[model samples]
Target: MAHSEIHLELLLGKQVLDSTGKPVGRLEEVRAEREGDEWIVRRYLIGVPALLERLSTWTIGLAILHSLGARNLHGGYEVPWEQMDLADPQKPRLRCTLEELKTLEQSNSQ
Candidate 1:
């Protein structure tokens, strides 16, 4: 199999678009695991919630938002590794629609 390399830093904070060219969110965090000397990506986290998670303040941020009556304000998406098109690392995009991705809440419930 052929593989290409992209610096994680370049992907961070990049706005990810959907299949139809609609903006989804920024690439805030990347979920990966070590395997046989390789760090394999599992998924890409996007949006404000992802940013909070990357900063290790997800719980606290959510609590504050809820307390402020902003229950619906916190949101994000979890794009599976296979769902993201990284061919253009500078402008990462989703292979699927936003609706097909798992929301932060949905992933938390699982």
Candidate 2:
């Protein structure tokens, strides 16, 4: 990590912008892996579904929302950490367009 690079903890809840400066969503969660002694962030999950996951007891609510197509209201995407530019920290931007990012998979928790 660069001296100016911010940690993933600081990145949570930060808004993410596409390469075109379009607002996508906030950084709801981060996926990381431990390599040797360092924890390297792999992806930044942005959307309401990601946010909902943080609330562990929302299973029934989430299922209802999904069944009613409310999940589409808060569609989530996962951007590879390497493709993100966090120089501003407050407004991390993706190197690619929003469509290029991977769509987050929904769980089978119905």
Please name the candidate that would achieve the greatest TM-score relative to the true structure.
Answer: 1
Q: For all the candidates, what are their Cα RMSDs to the real structure?
A: 1.5, 3.7
lDDT of 1 at 101: 88
Scored against the true structure, residue 55 in model 2 reaches a CA lDDT of: 60
Q: Which stretches of candidate 2 lie over 4 Å from their true place?
A: 1-5, 64-71, 106-110
Predicted candidate 2 versus true structure: per-residue lDDT over 3-86, tens digit per residue: 344676788888899999999898888878988977787887888777776565346667888798864464578788788888
Q: List runs of model 1 lying over 4 Å from the truth.
A: 66-69
Q: Clash totals for all models, in order?
A: 0, 0
Taken over the whole model, the C-alpha lDDT of each candidate is 0.91, 0.77
Span of 10 residues, lowest total lDDT, candidate 1:
66-75
Best by lDDT: 1
